[model samples]
Target: MKNLFPILLMLIIMVNASAHGGKNHEHANIFENLQGNNKAAILMVHFGTTHDDTRALTIDALNKKAQAEFPGVELREAYTARIVIKRLGERGIIKQKPQDVLAQLKKEGYTHILIQPSIIIDGVEMESLQKDVVEVQSQFKEIRIGDPLLYSPEDYEKLIDVLTKNIDSETAYIWVGHGTYDSNTAQYAMLDYMLKARGHTNCFVGTIEGYPSFDDMHQQLKASRLKKVVLVPLMFVAGEHAKNDIAEDWKNDLEKEGYSVEVKMEGLGQNPEVQDLYISHLKFKSAHRKIGIIEKKAIYEVTGEKME
Candidate 1:
C-alpha cells in the first residue's frame, strides 16, 4: 500500500509536467547555454497587420506564448510591413521597423541576441531580415537568426498535424495562403503533396499569388467529388486575406462551381499547436546557436509521430 502511494505521486508529477510542456524547463536550460558574455535578448519580428481584433487572437497570442517559454529573457518586437506600421502609427499605436529595432538592441549592449521571425515561409521577409542582420552585424557579439517555419521536411509534418488537429477527416480543407514569387513558394505545393502523401487526401493548399491558383483548386475539388469544403487561411492573422480573399472571393467562386463552401475564419497563429511550433523554432535556434543549422530529429516536436 505504501509503495502504491509513491507510484501514484510519480504519475501525478509526470501528468503535470507533460500538460504544462514536457521538457520545457530542460529546453529553457539549454537555451541559457546560448548566451554569451554580455546580456541576452530576443527580437520577435513579424508582418504587422492593421486589424486589431484578429491581431490580438493571432499575433498577440503567439508573442505571449513565446514570452511564457522564455520567462526571464528580455524580449522585443518589430514589424516588417511598413504600410501596416504607418497605419498603426496614424492610429497612435507606435511600432518600430525591423532594422531600427535591431539597431536599438545593439545600442542597448545586448551581445548574445536572437532574431526570431514569426514568418511561415522563407521569402521576401527573410531576405529583408538577412539584410538587416548584415547591417547590424558589427555591433553585436553574436547575433543569430532563426529559420522561418517550414525549412525542413519535418516541419511540414508538424504543420500538417497541427493544422489538421481539429479538422474532420471526411471534409476537404482548402488552405489559402498569401503567395510570393520567390523559389520558396514551392512550399505550398509541397504542403499539398504532404497532405496527400500522408493519406490526408481531403486537404488541399492554394495561394493568393502563387502556383495552384483558384482554377487548380477547383479542378482538384472537381475530381474529389466532395460537395462541401472548408476554406482555412494558412496565414498569421485572419485579416484581409482570410476575410475578403479566402472567405469571400474563394467562397463565392466555390459556391458558383456548385459546391458548398464553409469559411473557418481562423488563422494558423490561432492554433495553439502552431504557435508552439514557432516557439520551438526560437528555442531550437537558441539551443543550436553554435551549430548554425538544425539537426532533424532533435528540435521539431513531431519527428516520430505516426500520422492518421
Candidate 2:
C-alpha cells in the first residue's frame, strides 16, 4: 500500500495537468511578449445582415456589449459579405470590408489589432477572413484572431449549456445552422451528439446546406415520437435564413408531417450568454497578441498543402 501511494499521486497529477493544459493554456500573461507603445484596437467582423431588426438585436447588441466591456478601447466593425454590404450601401448605409477596415486602422496609427469574428464555426468564411488578415499583417505590429463559437471541446460544452438552459425536454428541439460544404460542417453533427450525451436527448441539430440535413433530423424526430418541435436558429442573426428557412419552410414541412411547430425567431447572438462567450474569446486573443491565421488542419484540407 505504501509503494502504491506515489504511483497513484503521479497518475492524478498527470490527469490534472492534461486537462489544464488543453483548456487553460491561454492563462499566460497577455502582455508577456508584447513590446513598444501599443496602440491596440478591436475589430468585430460579422457575416453582414440586411435586416435592420435582427441586426439590432444580434450584431448591434453584441457590438455594444463589447464596447461596454472593453471601455475606452477603440472598437470597429467590418462585414464579410459583399452582397450585404452592397445592399446596405444602396440604402445609404456604409459598411466597410475587413481589408478596408484594417487599412484604415493602420492609417490611424494603431499598432496592435485583435479581430474577433461573429461566426458560429470555422468554415469557409473563417478561412477567407484569415487570408484577408494575412495579406495586410505587415501593416501592424501584432494581430491576433479569436476562435469561433465552437472551436474547442470546452466551447462545445459552453454552447450546449447556453442553448439548453431553458430547453423543454418533452418537446423535440431542432437547431438550424447554415451548414457549409467544407469539412467544418462536422461541428454541427458533433454538437448534436454532445447535446444527447449531456442528457438533452430531445434536442437535435441540422444544417440548411450541410450534413445532418432536414430529412436526417426529421427521421430522428419521427423515431423519438415527439409531436411538438421548436425550431431555433443556430446562426448568429435570425436574418433571411432563420426567418425564411426555419420559420417558414421548415415549419411548413414539419406541420405537414403532422407535427406542431413553434419557431423561436431568436438568433444565437441575442442570448447574453452567447455574447459573453464571444467577448471571452476576444479577451483571450487580446491577452496573447498572437498571429491570427487559419488552423493548419483547415489550410491543408482546403489547399491540399500543409502549413509549417
| TM-scores vs. true structure, each candidate | 0.82, 0.85
lDDT score, candidate 2, position 144: 80
Can you write out model 1's per-residue Cα lDDT over 117-213, one digit (the tens) per residue? 8888888889988998888788877777877777778899999888777777768889988988778789889999999999888889999998767
Model 2 Cα lDDT, one tens digit per residue, 1-308: 89966755644443344344343332333335546766878899999899999899989999999899789789999999999999999999999999999999999988878889999998999999999999998888777888899898899999999888877779999999999887888999999999999998899999999988999888888999999999999999999999898999999999999998999999999999999999998877765433114443443454454433
Candidate 2 to truth, TM: 0.85
Indicate the worst ten consecutive residues by lDDT in candidate 2: 21-30
The TM-score leader among the candidates is: 2
Clashing pairs in 1: none
Task: Give the count of colliding residue pairs in each prediction.
Answer: 0, 1
lDDT of each: 0.79, 0.85
Give the C-alpha lDDT of model 1.
0.79
